[model samples]
Target: MFRKSLDDLLNWKNSKTRKPLIIRGARQVGKTWLMKEFGKTHYEKAAYINFDNNERMESLFNGNLDIERIITALQIETGVKIGTQNTLIIFDEVQEVPRALTSLKYFCENASEYHIIAAGSLLGVALHPGTSFPVGKVEFLDLYPLNFLEFLSAMGNDELVELLKSKDFSLITTFKGKYIDLLKQYYYIGGMPAVVASFIEDADYEKVRQLQKEILMAYEQDFSKHAPNEAVPRIRMLWSSTPAQLAKENRKFIYGLIRQGARVKEYELAMTWLIDCGLIYRISRVT
Candidate 1:
């Protein structure tokens, strides 16, 4: 799939003052794919390290974070020779290892020549309370569900995308019917990468709906497994109410929609947790 972020990664690679990059997004938004794709296309080699459920990785980061030693260990792990100029070191599921997350700081301060990009689905929600994040020592990119143009590209309409991009209203008007049909499809598909991919392969609306439900199920599972115990019920309630909330004429967040008499103070933590997880966006009204 074509991702606009690939261009961003390229720019980061060439930047004179680039820091270790971190990609943050909700699960299933293609963070893992984007990181690997960036490396495969742009770098001579990619040292991909996934920190999920790997005790070896956990132990590596748990020890002293010597940048040289870590680089050597990663070379061994990925069987890719590490090089400052041509290697892309990827830390996948990095939040699973807090010290690994912290190590970005040392990479920035001590080994700025190397290219490093890290991503975690739950980076916003799962950092251990005391973990020292590499604040200001790393750059962050937030990936999101594919937008309309990316969706069109994935559907093999690159020329159409270019036509729209050029803003040639006279030529675009000739294809208005096709564009409207695609717009309707985009509405139903709605840009979730996995779901969109399935629709592309099968052109099955039922299957697309099924995939969306599965994504929602995974999110509910995250709420149970990662959210605080006290907030689980509220989180579930808030999530369940989202569809109805969007259905409202004004499409504004109303605490009372979750349940009668619900208030911001009572559910703010739940709301905040969802926003941090990238599952929802909060738009504040400008006074």
Candidate 2:
């Protein structure tokens, strides 16, 4: 799949004073896939590491911030030769290891030739006021779910996507039926990579819904595991109520939809948590 962010990645790769890159997005938004894809396409070699629960990787960055030593340890861990050449190093779930995130600063200063990209799911929550963030040492790209043009490309409708991009009103009008059908399918399928990929393979609505349900279940599990215990129930309630709220003609996130007389303050933290997790998108109305 072609992510718009790939262009940004290329620009960063070719920049004279490029820092390490951080690809931030909500869970299951294809962050890892995009990073790996970029590496495969552009770099001669890539070393990818995930810091989520690996104690050893955490321990590796636990001590010093020396750029050369850190790079050596990373090569040993991944067994991939990484140098200042055409190599990309990916740190997946770097928020799990704050020191690994901190090391980006040294990477930026001491060894600017090495290319690094890090991504995390709950990075927004991880960078608390007291945390040690590499403020000016990294470039960031936010990846969202596949947009309409990407979705079309994924579905083998590249020509239609090109036509839409060209803004040829007459051509677009002639093929309005095809575009309308694709639009309806896009709405029904949504943009989660897994769901869209599944739909592409089978074109089965039942299977698409099943995969979407699995994604929801995984997200709920993540909430239960990652969210604060005090706000877990409220988060579940607020998130679960989204479908019903949107089922109405107007999709306002009214507090009452969560429960009887649900005050804004009651679920504010939960709403914010969901937003940070990238599960729900809230758009404010224009005054």
Candidate 3:
């Protein structure tokens, strides 16, 4: 799994005045794996803490914003010796604990020596509900589904990736069949790590579809599990409508398509929720 984000991660690791870094992406896009890989390759150890449904961690940040106390709790929870210079601290699924999200500011201010990386599938959405974001306190890296070049690398086509990056269109045109074949595979597999990994190993289209379906199901479960009760139904409705929405010639996402004569005001929050969860991509027309 040669992720293109490795270059960005390497840059973050070598920066002289680095702040806490946040890896933002859609769910199952390998944010957690990328953090672990970065730590393994660049640091002596990684202190990984997942803030979802962990009572002790939730309590750690409930009362105060002391950086030392938070570090101690993280060390205790992860059993990794916290070294300012060598250890990489990863906060995974961080949106579950709002205070932990805000604590990045203190970390930036008081514990600048420590290398911290944070990632969450719903972090953007969580920050939207008026959560105090660590505005200037952290750096951000946005991860997307594997681009065509990454797909080539994942499938052991490093030479092809090299060629594409070289931009020799005449030579590339000679191998257009190869690129087109891989592009079709990428379309059906769609850059989710698990799906791509399975397709790479087995070359089984049926298994790929099954994995995509499971991922879609997990996303629905996330809505019911983590989203506001009032917004869950709307989210589900908006999410389920995506295939139909994209199938049209004009993919601008009409609210009426979800129902007869539906208005944008009625489904605005639902659309926002789906976008927040990374289930849909929104493109607006600029006149």
Candidate 4:
């Protein structure tokens, strides 16, 4: 899908002082695909390790975090020979194994030559209370859904993208109708990779709406599963009320909209949780 982040990955690889890389994003924003794609095109080989529901990985990381021993286990699990050069090591859902995340510190300090990229859907909420993170020892890349230009490219409008990039308003004006049509499509698809891909294949508006609903349902399930138990109900309430809140003329968050007499103190955590999960953005009015 031609992510612009691939270019950033290349720069990270070429940096003389590169550290282990961590990609952070919300679920279904294509973190896994981006990491694998980066590895496939940029390295001699890629060793992929998904920590989700893998007992072997859970057991391997539960013990000592000796860098050598961990490398051997990764090679055995991924069936790719471990190397210090020309290999991209991927740690998918590293939050599933907190120790695996802490081990990135060791990788950065000791086995600096090996290229590693790690990602997790719930990194913001999944870590245990005291799990050590590799602060400052590793680099990070924040990924987002495809923007308008990338979305244009994905829809096989590369020439249109090039024309826009050229900044020739006269030339671009000739195709205003085409651009406006595409803008409407992009608005409906809204940059979610799965939704956009489905639209690309089937071009069905009904199917696009279905996919979006499913994604929202998955997120609601995540709230119950991962969010603090006390905040689940409030989160759901705040989330479901968002559209109505935005629909108002003022367009500012009002506690009253969530429920009758709801106060900031009552729903702050719920709002914060949504923001942390990247499910919603909070834009404050300028003072």
Name the candidate that leads on lDDT: 1
Q: What is the descending TM-score order?
A: 1, 4, 2, 3
Model 1, which residues run further than 4 Å from truth? none
Best by TM-score: 1
RMSD of 2: 1.7
TM match of model 4 to true structure: 0.97
Better of 2 and 4 by lDDT: 4
- TM-score, one value per model: 0.98, 0.94, 0.93, 0.97
Error of 2 at 170 (Å): 0.9
lDDT of 1 by residue, 1-287 (tens): 99999999999999999999999999999999999988999988999999989899899989989998999899888899999999999999998898999999999999999999999987889888999999999999999999989998999999999999999999999999988999999999888899999999999999999998899899999998899999999999999999999999997788888999998999989989999999999888887
Alpha carbon lDDT at 219, candidate 1: 91
Error of 1 at 180 (Å): 1.1
lDDT of model 1 at position 117: 97
After superposition, which runs of candidate 2 have C-alpha atoms over 4 Å from their true positions? 126-130
Total clashes in model 2, counting residue pairs 3 or more apart in sequence or in different chains: 0
Worst lDDT run of 10 residues, candidate 2, spans: 122-131
Give the C-alpha lDDT of model 4. 0.92
lDDT of 3 by residue, 1-287 (tens): 89979989988888998999999988889999999999998899999999879899889877698988888888999999899988999999888888888999999999899899999987756654767889999999999888888888999999999989899999999999999998988888888888889987898999998998898888888887768889888778777778898899986777776778888887888887777777777787899
Instruction: Write down the TM-score for model 2.
Output: 0.94
